[model samples]
Target: MPNGEERPISYASRSLTKAEVNYAQIEKEALGIVFGVRKFHQYLYERRFTLMTDHKPLVKIFGPKTNLPAMAAVRIHRWSVELCAYQYDIQYKRSEDHGNADMLSRLPDGQEQETEEEKVCFSYINDMPVSAADIAKETKKDQTLSKVLQFTLNGWPSHTEDTRLKPYFQRKEEITVDAGVLQWGIRVIIPATFRKQLLNELHENHLGINKTKAIARSYVYWPNLDDDIEAMIKD
Candidate 1:
């Protein structure tokens, strides 16, 4: 930043190769650091700038005086060594706070030809309206769902399979409740059948896919939720 204002010097994005796409999450993250530095080494080689990443594990593995992790894969070892050439510090930022990379990763193929206005911009909303409050109340009214909701609001036991909460047993491990709101990690956990209705409520604002997804990220959880949103918008 020159004169205390942030300025963009250079940026790059690319599709992951088939091999890269198949890597485990950790390896993919490691490769990203490697690739980013290699791409910008000329500019970065002589200067020191902190490296920021949402992947906390990368920070642990690369920190000073840290020994090579015993169970680390061979690929990780090589990447860790490569990072040693740089003068930098590793800092952690939450994934939700790191949207650009996440958005870039979600880009559909053939997006290169799309104009800047076409990217990160949305034209319209195609979702039906639904009441989020009514749905939440009704879902909470169910005896089975209530227990899960309470557990989320209060706290869940470390151990699972409580017979009283049997209905949640199948996916109990995926459940999370924060600030009186139930979530499946970052995804909000709601009744399976009501997902589309909830998505519609979240999407009805015509807020663009990423913005809608961001709204959903704060309150809902489901498998393939992002993909479902994209399909819902298109359909």
Candidate 2:
């Protein structure tokens, strides 16, 4: 204790996927954590890892079963089934106690890599009755909903106007019918990285057809476009 404050001896942490993504470190961490699990479990066919963590929900989930009816039970049950091949003992500690594991959690982003081994192990099915394709199909159907829309690396186009092109389509801030006559709308590139904002626009109903159209044009015309987004827009 620097000032005689008690410091924990165990460690606990969770890794964030969308934060500072450093490719090299991501590669290393990917190997150690994500891939390591796949490979480690592959050969052992049976083992229990002591996971140190301070995340309350994760602790309850990974810890032993309890009689209490909890939502976390669903999550834990799923984890238990998936990790059944290898035993996992979930234990708790102060965040300070779990320094080493926390370091793995803090290991600058991108250290987690996309590995072939993991892809194989984490593949669509094991004992589960459903295939990922089923869920994906549902998602695709949802996107195709007339009110809802779908956009991806491939798709979108053939519904845009010619005289006024909609080069892009993306989720955005919600729309709010303006006080004056400026009826709002939305326009975004099909494959939008700024999905949160785009979704907001839809929920709020702030942006309208015209604005959505303009945003589309801007996205299509952006420099990164490989082919003319305008051409694709009107497709």
Candidate 3:
């Protein structure tokens, strides 16, 4: 209450609801839009939240992209005009951090997380595709997957039987055990004994860093194996 003799009440005392506090609203369908990034930008608009994402296709249709993927270009061009109404900020965050946000976005249309209705302008910036050739390069010392890839490039090696080992193979050739085998034009063919050993290596070698490398190496050294490591990497 205010009296003639008392100072008028200030807006600082007023409380804000979800809708009242937000002016901009945004969403990223894929894991590309991360939480820390989302939250940080949300803090910027003060009364609004603008969405940003990595799924170039979706981002272009939803927000602004300066120099981004093609899908991003189309959307941002359209969104820029809509964004003239308010000031918004865009930022990036890693995928793992956005786990919660990604999960919430996938809910069926009727079940979207309850958020105050916000004016959204879908747009994106566009640019050339990333040059994977440099980063995805293969080297001789790559070993395992790399070696297996080189072996394939050189063509499949001949297999011969020896009594020393029932199959004379170091690893098993299970279809399911390998990733993207069909794409590489190679399928592992080996005895059950080889399978058991490979399985043991997979289970026993618990270190997370080189699991792919070891499995790939086993494939390279094993019997009747075919597939390019580069293809596997792409797949």
Candidate 4:
């Protein structure tokens, strides 16, 4: 009965990683398309179907005949590569007209599963100066960070009087929790108890202030992170 009646077969959803949460709006839209295609790969791999999205620009970027620009973002290139394996056509529907997908996205089913991105985020734990478990446990013990973690997961309040949480509150949007450890845009938020030890490790090789700060900037974050590095060097 191919009478042009729309039907739903399956649904899937997952949360974004700390880094992904910071992607540009267009990038996020592109990611959603990739996520859906991948989630239903078994059903859609060899079959032809219409991929509908409210993000109009995607029509051009993902259309069957459009050539991806050489200056497009790396992520766009990667996602396009993934779509190359499948046979489908991309179309744009106005947001108001795409109520079903929009509503489902707004009220996604409640189920938590580790995504590949999170797995990659956790892969480097063994190489870190502090283990993920240590960070998680210490985070729970540190009153400020523990509170920050709770706020990040549950949702932050409009205002807070605690001076300790002020800095975190100011940047609440950037904070995220992964397996209990808090992170700020991919940088691990080191707990107070472990900062001293981590500082020692950073300074162990006498990498100097600039080098030390550069290394710390890449892997970890905390209040006054730069100041702490400077103080450790002076002391």
Quick one: best TM-score, which candidate? Answer: 4
Q: lDDT of all predictions, in order shown?
A: 0.60, 0.34, 0.32, 0.77
| Model 2 C-alpha lDDT per residue in residues 1-235, reported as the tens digit of each score | 5785544453223343332121222122222333334644554456555554454434543345633232111222444445555666756668666544444544443334443533452242332233334423333343232122222222334464432223222311111111110001211122223333333443354455455445444322222333333233334
Candidate 1 lDDT score at position 30: 69
User: Residue 3 deviation, candidate 1, in Å?
Assistant: 6.8
What does candidate 3's lDDT look like per residue over 50-118, in tens digits?
A: 555533333443344444333222223334444534454454545654443543344333322423222
Ten contiguous residues minimizing lDDT sum, candidate 4: 102-111
Mark the 10 consecutive residues where model 3 has the least summed lDDT. 121-130
Pairwise TM-score winner, candidates 2 and 3? 2
Give the Cα error of residue 23 in candidate 4, in Å: 16
Could you tell me the TM-score of candidate 3? 0.22
Q: Residue 212, candidate 3: how far off, in angstroms?
A: 54
TM-score of decoy 4 = 0.57
TM-score of 1: 0.42
- List TM-score per model, in order: 0.42, 0.28, 0.22, 0.57
The number of the candidate with the highest lDDT is: 4
lDDT of 1 by residue, 1-235 (tens): 5676544465665666543443445555766778778878998886887787887767877775578644344456667788888888888889776544544445544322433432221111112243444445655775666777765434455666656465454444345332233434334456556777777776678888899888776655555678999988887
Clashing pairs in 1: 187-220, 187-221, 188-220, 188-221
Q: Any idea how many clashes model 1 has? A: 4
